[model samples]
Target: MSQFDAQILVAAFELSYNDWTLGLRKSNMQVDVLLQNEVLRRGSSILEQTASSLSILPAENADIEGSNLSLRYDDGALLILGEMSYFDLEGLFVDTDSFYLTTGYRFGQWLPHITYARLNSTDDDIRRAPRIETIKNNLPAGSADQIAVATVQSLAPILWNQESTSYAIGVNYFFSPQVVGKLEAKMVTDRNGTISQFQNANTSGASAPVIPDDNRILIYGLSVDVVF
Candidate 1:
């Protein structure tokens, strides 16, 4: 299909007094895809291959809209931040929402922080598509076309959707004005059988990927940074 166009608007505000500072920001975005005719044609072709008498028709233009809001506050010794974001893809039949929060405290030359984040996605629109509905209703239960459609519908959400939560704790040490040492540990847990962002481990020697039974993982990291 044709390319998409996007428009965005943003606003931000900040205040600082003595050693305390606070900031807020908001943004909105819209994306439009020029694929109505192409989509209908392809959808109709798929139905024809399945020997369905139904034909797909053009619908509303494909579009996605999203918004984000965030806030941050910091004093000489304490820091806090939070953000939320959401997106609705009208044509693709997908919606996503996410949240994040972090807090940290500084003591002399050291700072320790903890963070939490969550992401969720759904494809209710895809399940409600005319082409998919036709296939589900018209095709035989064991037919190839029916099986293919069912497989795709079952795997799409697992491969492209997300429902996960993450928690992390980290500490930073200022070795000097221009150098720092950092250590961090993080844990991620998959939710609702979604694995869109996780790395799947393979043990079967087969080329195909396999999901891990344990959906939770812990990661450790250490680093040193020097700025000149």
Candidate 2:
């Protein structure tokens, strides 16, 4: 899911994936040895307002219910340049049909790289709300005991399919001799999907897909790589 167009005409070429585990180096300059290190990051989850309405019952402070269910994913990626640098300011463009690849060297101290990853969450459990009813029947005269019957007035309806898009961006630090840290940010578009489902209260034939709310959420984290 990646491509490398190394422009060694200007500098060395070095890249890493999954925190320096998967490394690829192609440089015009000769290197004494390929340096490698672990890169880590830490982040937090920003709950959106609409995330609560997704459930049938009222969402408590995560105390009454389990963790606010999330069907999306976001992570950080790091790369060590100088070990691998493309051409000059000519720039490079690589496309993955879903996302794009970009990098930059600025301020003499920071080398920023950015990329996009597609996300799809269609596995949400939005079952229809159930219906319940209580029935009471009169007994025959005083000699008989009271009779009561409980039955289902009607079954609850089901919520139609829900889809989402998880567009993301990531930046990593590739300082000389060491990779400092990494950061990533992702946003899910409101009701953003190619095809979606719907539900109606009519309980008639098939219902249309239900609509989701609008909310902005942010999730970030930090971590460290311990090498003994």
Candidate 3:
């Protein structure tokens, strides 16, 4: 048996005077796992026996909470935006703290902007997996339990334990009040020797473990938006 429940609340305010406008927004969310099946507990042998039948491992009884706040200011020609967010995932994933900021100016139908953003894991040391050799050396050689424990420990760090910073520049062209086109270029740099959400494309094979590569990535995006 498994049970889950969640609640969310949002509040926003806006004030406008002539050509200047200011706004604030806040949100909070909480999730509670009321019940969990016995078979789903960590280190349960049922998962190995029935691995093919299960597609997901549900969280045990835990509380997951998050909140965010944002402030914005926009005049007829200039705009500024900022936001901060945090999450406590209760070990379902790595807890995270993030921030974002943007500044933009409008000229006729064209709006150009610059943005800076950062995301950091608050519990990186706890989530990082121990090396396989370290785990094996401490355990009895060729023990049946050795392989099982080693595999799990080696894969733990793959669970979103990284930090990154991003810088972006973009332009939005307003075709009308309801339509817009955007072009953006962004660069993401890894921090603290951690791989920030990027997977290695050169995996050896299914039998090989996929590792995170420490490298910077550049992204280019073009898109159009239409509002009904």
lDDT of each: 0.65, 0.28, 0.64
Q: What is the lDDT of candidate 1?
A: 0.65
Candidate 2 versus the native: TM-score? 0.26
Candidate 1 vs candidate 2: the TM-score winner is 1
Which residue ranges in model 2 land beyond 4 Å of their true spot? 1-109, 121-162, 175-179, 190-213, 226-228
Instruction: Rate residue 206 of model 1 by lDDT.
Output: 67
CA shift of 49, model 2, Å: 40
Ranking by lDDT: 1, 3, 2
Which whole-number lDDT from 0 to 100 does residue 113 have in model 1? 95
Let me know the TM-score candidate 1 reaches against the reference structure. 0.64
Q: Candidate 2 — what's its lDDT?
A: 0.28
* lDDT (10s digit) by residue, model 2, range 112-228: 554433322222322221211111133243221211111101111222233433455655454543545566676655435322222332333443333434443345645433333
CA shift at 212, candidate 2, in angstroms? 8.6
Instruction: State in Å the error of residue 6, model 2.
Output: 40
Name the lDDT value of residue 166 in candidate 3.
95
Q: State which candidate has the highest TM-score.
A: 3
Model 1: colliding residue pairs: none
Q: Per-residue error at 1 for model 2, in Å?
A: 31
lDDT score, residue 18, model 2?
38
Off by over 4 Å in 1: 1-62, 91-94, 122-133, 136-151, 175-180, 199-209, 224-228
User: What TM-score fits each model?
Assistant: 0.64, 0.26, 0.69
